[model samples]
Target: MPSLATTETLIASSGRKSFRVVFEGFLHLMLLACAVVSIITTVGIVLVLLIESLQFFRDVSVWEFLTGTKWSPLLKPQHFGILPLFCGTFLVAAGSALVAIPIGLGTAIFLSEYASPIVRDIVKPLLEVLAGIPSVVFGYLAVVFVSPIIKSLFASADLFNAANACIVVGFMILPTIVSLSEDVLRSVPRSLREAAYALGATKLDVTIGVVVPAAMSGIMASFLLAIARAVGETMAVTLAAGATPRLTLNPLESIQTMTAYIVQVSQGDTPAGTLEYRTIFAVGLTLFIFTLLLNVIAQWILSRVREKYE
Candidate 1:
């Protein structure tokens, strides 16, 4: 009993609605495909690392790799101990943490608690620009500039030393910590600051006692993540810290990190299927494990902090 015009209108509306549903379904499929691709890529990387590392372990004992102090895989009478690499890696990471944590946290505090809006807007971008600079540039800077400074300060320091790498890697990870910590500090609720003020607390007391504690979870997470980055950093460490795989803790001495060794072996001279070639995967797996553990710890801290704050 509907008129023709009304029938046409209804059909047209239904068609449009159907088309919209189809479009939305297509979009959802596309998003799902992207997510699946990411998961597949990650799984593929893990599988490759595991398969290659298993082959590597077959030739070299895991105990030796874990507990051994020497690591001269490519040289004559090759050694496969990974402890020196481990020590060197952690040395840079720890030193970098010392440089980054205090400066980064202080910068975050100044930005979040003290800087004017205009100053923050100007300074934050400049700070983040450090993150965008290539690792190779930092390496060059370390070699050309930082290493010389260290040599001047300490006559015993080598041109390629752990301290040089540490300083450069610290600068490399600084932006991440500062940016993340600042965001976390800013996310603390305004009500907390107001409450502190009402109780006769100074701005410093409120910032230190209330806002920082409230955001400590996020700040700690950022620290872990930045340290992970420093641990995994390759080029700068490679250039600044030479290929010496010594287990000593002296910052003035040359050293080699796991990532640096991987880079050394991956330069196409080592034949495929050889023990040396396979070492890269083994080192890669170790680096992956280190970063994964850091991420897991960061996540646990973040969740616990969030629960407390919320």
Candidate 2:
């Protein structure tokens, strides 16, 4: 009963609405597919690690692997204790944390609270450029440059040592800490700053007392993630930290991390399905578990922070 023009308009509107609904459904399906792919990939990796690690543990008892201080799996008498690797890994991680946390946090605070926009824009990108450099390049840099400098300062330092690796890995993780912590610091409410200012608080006092506490959750999350990254690092650690798997705390001594051992075994020299080859998966699984725990903790902290802020 409507006029011809009115009927055509109605039809066009209905068609457009139908098209929008279909398009939205397609987008949702695409997103779901992407999520499923990621889940499947993670499951696949875990399954592979578990299967291979089971084979490894069949020969090397979990008790020995967890508590043993020696880690010479390929050498004569094949000691399979993983504690030395743990020590080496944590030595680099702790040293890197010491080097990175103060400097990275200070840089983030400066960028977020005080730097002019132009200085921030220029400096942040340059800092992030450090992140983009290849890990192998960092390894080479530690060997070729950092080691010599350390040796010059401390003649007792090994050519390949935990200290050299720690310095390089700290630089490697600096951008992550700076970027994430800066974002968190900037996200602190302007109202909070204003309130502190109203009470006669200086800018420094407001930042240290108010903004930092507000952003602590996110800052801690960044620190955990950076240390996790340091734990899982391979080439830089392997090349700079040497192949000696020893249970010593001296950063100047040559030592091997878990990831480094995996690398050493994963080279084409190790035959397929052998005990040496299986050690790779065992080490990989250990590294994976530790990194996963760190990530889980970071996520938990972030979630709590979000709930508080929201």
Candidate 3:
């Protein structure tokens, strides 16, 4: 029913709208492509690990692998106990949490509640810089600097011990905890703070009692993710925690984590298709499963927390 110019204008508007729809569709498709790539890579790795671990289980009983007390795979009478590796990983993860939780939460509280704009600008960047340091550099520092100090302080400390690796890994993951926790704390509604202030609550009281509780889920998620990071760390553990898989809780004694064992087996002269080669894949599978579980738990906690707060 439109005239020629009016019809052209209408057609142009339709075309623009169509183009916008197509562009949005394309953007969504691109995001799907990224997700697909990630899924494919993860599936491929899992499949490889599963196959190799099946082969390993064929030679070594599942029960033995799971329950054995000795773990000397290269010795004449090979032992395949995973307990020592689990202990080492837990020690490092626990130690990392001990180090990261206090410092990280304190930093987060300071940043969100106490710090002025200028102080925050300086501190946040410095905290991020900690994350930027290479894992290998941290490994070197653990071996060269931390190990000696630990050995000096502890009478029973081994030159290469779980303590050194745990301390170093803790430092490495500190930034993650601090930054994520700070962001979560900062995201709390200003109205909440104002209400507390109106109630005559001190800044420290409001921050510790209200804000921290509100952000507890997010902080917990950060801690779990940091634990996952510590568990999966390889280089620092390999360099600082000697390649001795022994089931002990003594932090000063040398130990080998699952990741460190994988690194050891991979870097050695183990031929392809051999038991040692397969063992690395098995260990990798275990490490992958552990980290995946931690991440899933973290995500779950984060979602629940967000739902509550939002």
lDDT of 1 by residue, 1-310 (tens): 9999999999999999999999999999999999999999999999999999999999999998888878898889889899999999999999999999999999999999999999999999999899999999999999999999999999998889999999999999999999999999999989899999999999999999999999998899889989999998999999999999999899999999999998888899999999999999998999899888888878877788762555
Clashing pairs in 2: none
Rank the candidate models, highest lDDT first.
1, 2, 3
Query: 188-225 in candidate 2: lDDT tens per residue?
Result: 98899999999999999999999998999889988998
TM-score of 3: 0.90
Model 1 score (lDDT): 0.94
Best by TM-score: 1
Please name the candidate that would achieve the greatest lDDT relative to the true structure. Answer: 1
Model 3 residue 211 CA deviation (Å) reads 0.9
Off by over 4 Å in 3: 1-28, 296-307
Query: What ranking of all candidate models by TM-score puts the best one first?
Result: 1, 2, 3
lDDT of 3 at 39: 100
lDDT for model 2: 0.93
Candidate 2 is scored at a TM of 0.93
